[model samples]
Target: MLTNRQRNHIDVPTLTAVLVLMVLSLGVVYSASASWAYEKFGTSSRLLNSHLIKVLLGIGAMFVGMMLPYKIYQRLTKPALIAALVFLGITLVLGGEMKGATRWLHFGGMSFQPSEFAKFALLFHLCALVSTKQELMKDFKRGFIPVMIWVGLVSVFVLAQPNFSAGVMILALSIVVLYVGCARLSHLFLAAAAMLPVIAVYVLMAPYRRERIMMFLDGHSNGKPNYQLLQGIIGFGNGGLFGVGPGESRQRDFFLPESYGDFVFSIVGEEYGLIGTVLFMGLFLFIMLRGFRIAKYAQDDFGRLLALAITSTVTLYALVNASVALGILPTTGQPMPFVSYGGSSLIFSSFAIGVLLNISAFTDMHPREQKHGGQLSEAATRAAASDFGETSARPRPEGFVELSRDARPEGSVEPLNRAAGRQAGVGTVY
Candidate 1:
């Protein structure tokens, strides 16, 4: 049912970039999962098959997200957010435990993590609220509290599940979004001051969390080199300049736990060496640049915020995962986006990118022929502006930001299809 009928409208390069990661993930996943699978299940490909199926299913989710009108998601934002909260509540009541934390729900032989979906549902809904409520963002009571309430609720639920790091990351991501939406800096600073102590207490109060913190602070606290962290570092050290070669990771042979999951980056380093690791890291950097460019040229404020939030969220998680694997940060159970073995994260992340691509499809970056494919026209450059939006292949001036369709200083709206009614001062806050 899903096809690429509107490929010309979307950002092909972004799509291809993600696809390359997913494809290469197949081999890396198999290499990392082989020993674990054979030890647990009599076969080496069990986890590989599982990861591959998730990748395929994620592709389908991506197409669905790409083909549908991104505006529809705005209309569905409220209900989607409510549904995510309900699912999170359900998870707490009846969810499976791993690593001593409750975060996943199994249904009909498939596992789902409500927090993954909640993270983006909160983001989409946040973008909706922030874009429409820009006028009120500077007010602490009227604007800030209302938006922060949603963020606080989702984060509380995640933390109650005992997922401290994810809860903190979700909260941090929302704060960044609020800051970018131009919420008053004073209010954010005051609010964070109030929350910092609570967060510190919460982290220190948990015995297990405290242990992890101590272990991170003192790797020899228990007189060992932090088994997991040391193994991961050894993986990187095994490959000095080049690599030990593909599928030749000694760490994967039961030395590193969950090599195909949270620590997959270490397996990558061990097998591909520094050259391949940098190339892999470079891909993420490239994706970030491309994502920001799309946001810069989005058709509207909501589109701009959505594109940036999604891209930044994925990149942040990837950064955290890699940092943990390299022992640069304390172990956080977050998986590498697209590359780690998981179902919910891959699907949700892919769907979010699909929406971003849909945003790009309406921008000047879209490859469609303006006067038949070569030149630019007014409509072709509508995503651009003298301000927040892009003007051409070249960049915009220094300090301009997003402008609402209803607030364009020129007081003109696009006289075309969707832009006519929607851009003609009609609000998009359905």
Candidate 2:
């Protein structure tokens, strides 16, 4: 049980990032969704209102996640992983398909994406497993094989849904966790080699996938696949150095499809400009650095693994999102952490931040000290006395007496008059 003082020692860098991103997201989402809202609901504020509600709900979920003891996650890891897999299966059976991908489960009016939660749950389980098997990680059979099988199962299911981007993200995330967990470099290299042919086949079999790669590498000749990329680039160009100003983006007005989802960065660049984009990039880098620092200084193996898993997951997602926005990779439906307009992504991001905060609580740079007000005051007083060259001239409390140099014997260097005290039957005085 962490005391209040102990809990306060937890660094909130991730939380700070979350707050900044949320504010930016809310403003941009409002602007990006306004035109669509007006067309659908006959009111421009409808999307903004709904997004505000989602933000409030996400914040509430974050509060719960951050307040829960990190140890509780250990107990819940197995169950959570199972539940995530079950939900993923359910999504395949009854999920809603959007843009030809079955990623969301719709119940009544609410749609939930299981993949978002699955990422976190998989992280939790992997961390727990790796922490317990540090020695085994170096062994191919006990460590690499099991983890690969586990990830492969999930990947097969995700790819079966034809959500190639999600599958790729999951595979990347698992590889990162394995690397951080100290799997042999040779094993990773071998695995990478093995994956190449499969990746080639997958790409060759899917015409759109292959087209995306070609368009990404060569720029579309007919500007068919490059339309979104060109629009995104134009958004950034229009803003110039400072920006066109918030809510003034011409691109978000039906010019950039799904501007509020994966390409929210375009809206950001269009509205906030080059400066804003740089700032956003800087914030994400700072967050990744902070999370790595937390993982590096975590107190125990479990904490270290947990921190690494969370940090890697967030970092990978951010990189993929940026790559997609920059047209270095095909655009996927992955949302920018905290900056995209989606309930599941936002909630999962908050949860990941919460885990990072939990790891921060146990860092060694801030050691646990006595927290009673009186004890702290006493320690401070003693420190101040030492600083001021004060001498102990008065009698002190029985258990709190201060020893003097002169209390030693004349010919001996012993500070305590042990011999004299023993002779006097008063026990050794110190």
Candidate 3:
């Protein structure tokens, strides 16, 4: 529902970061895809034009997400999850194969990967539950079981598609969001241990996956299975500290497969060298920090958790992709967020950024808000205000007591005044 004109409230800093990344993505995609596109389609502009269109569409999707109130996401959580489940199921049954994996569902003239939407849908549901059921989160039976059912439901279909990397991403994202949501750490550890065997079996059942793992562990031996990894490393090594120069990467000329998609980071390294890659990573780090800042000052619990989940997911994907490209991890077909030439990844990332900026817009970081000399901390005041009516004359919630703001900077985590809550016998409402 959000239109560009109405999205003035979008967080300018985060928006700036996203725009810069998108520009960089455009440049990289153009450079990285030229050779591959020219060879495949007999026209150098084919992939570049398609990438440009996807970028524009992604920007539009971002603005739409920014225009809508994030609270709407909470309402849509259940239906969105259900829809994703159905779509993933349909993809598993009837989807055509790409790269030996049935991960995309093709329609008349278009295609979509359901897992992309499902990722965000699942995160939205997790945030909604975490925000609404804070107290219950500490209990394994009541908290962990119900939430993880959705995680499992999504993961089963993703793994069934044999998209092992995406399956791992979904499970990892769920675990991280749950941890951030305050699920018991011990239970999480136990759950992870229990999952190891299942994960092993899943990996071994597929020869390619097992080979990938083995290659990852011992890439030095012959380097046959790790041809892609070796080629990527060679690209980076060729760049050295300064790089070979933008749009001049030799690796894109068929030496490294999928250079414009999953291995785009190698293109970045080969072209820009270590300095460029470092600066690129710094941008992602900036986004991560800015996102967490917005989460810290979010208007409510839902906003806080939602922002964190979205931020974590984006940063995690970027990090993992870069790691794989650098040979720090196994090849995982995970695309570099904004830098990769993938419509699904780009659009989903843009949408997440849009929601994050919206949340940031509602945060209380403005000088005017800080000028109000009330002793109550911003978070306590906001939460309590929501609990009671906005009007001060409304009866205060029973046992409610305001706590003074900590002397920390804006968007820093303030220690919960648990003593005050204990004295009030409310046992930490927010």
Model 1, stretches more than 4 Å misplaced? 1-6, 367-369, 372-376, 380-430
1-430, model 3: which lDDT tens digit per residue?
A: 6454335445687788888888898888888888888888999888888888898989998887787789988878989899999999999899989878899889997788899999999988998876665555666776687788889899889999988889989999999887776667787888899878999899989877878888999984345757889899999999999999988999889899888888888888999999999988998999999988777667676788888888999899999999999888888998888779888888988998889988876654432233347676564466456445463523333333221124323233333345543453433221
Better TM-score candidate (2, 3): 3
lDDT of each: 0.82, 0.74, 0.80
Best by TM-score: 1
lDDT of 2 at 23: 81
lDDT of 2: 0.74
**What are the runs in model 3 whose C-alpha is more than 4 Å off?**
1-9, 220-225, 368-430
| Ranked by lDDT, top first | 1, 3, 2
Ordered list by TM-score, greatest first: 1, 3, 2
Which lDDT tens digits does candidate 2 get at residues 1-430? 5668647767766778878878878898988888978888899888777777788777877776666777778768878877888988999998899867788999898889888888788778777666555445557886678777767767777777777888888888888777766667788889889987886787788878878777888888356658888888889899889999999999888888878888888888888888998898888888888887787556555677778778777777777787787777777778888878888888877877877787777554344344575464444445345445553422233222111123332222222233432343432110
Worst 10 residues of 1 by lDDT: 409-418
**Residue clash pairs of candidate 1:** 369-373
Lowest-sum lDDT 10-residue window in model 2: 395-404
How well does candidate 1 match the true structure in TM-score terms? 0.88
List RMSD in Å for every model shown.
5.4, 13.2, 6.8
Model 2: colliding residue pairs:
none
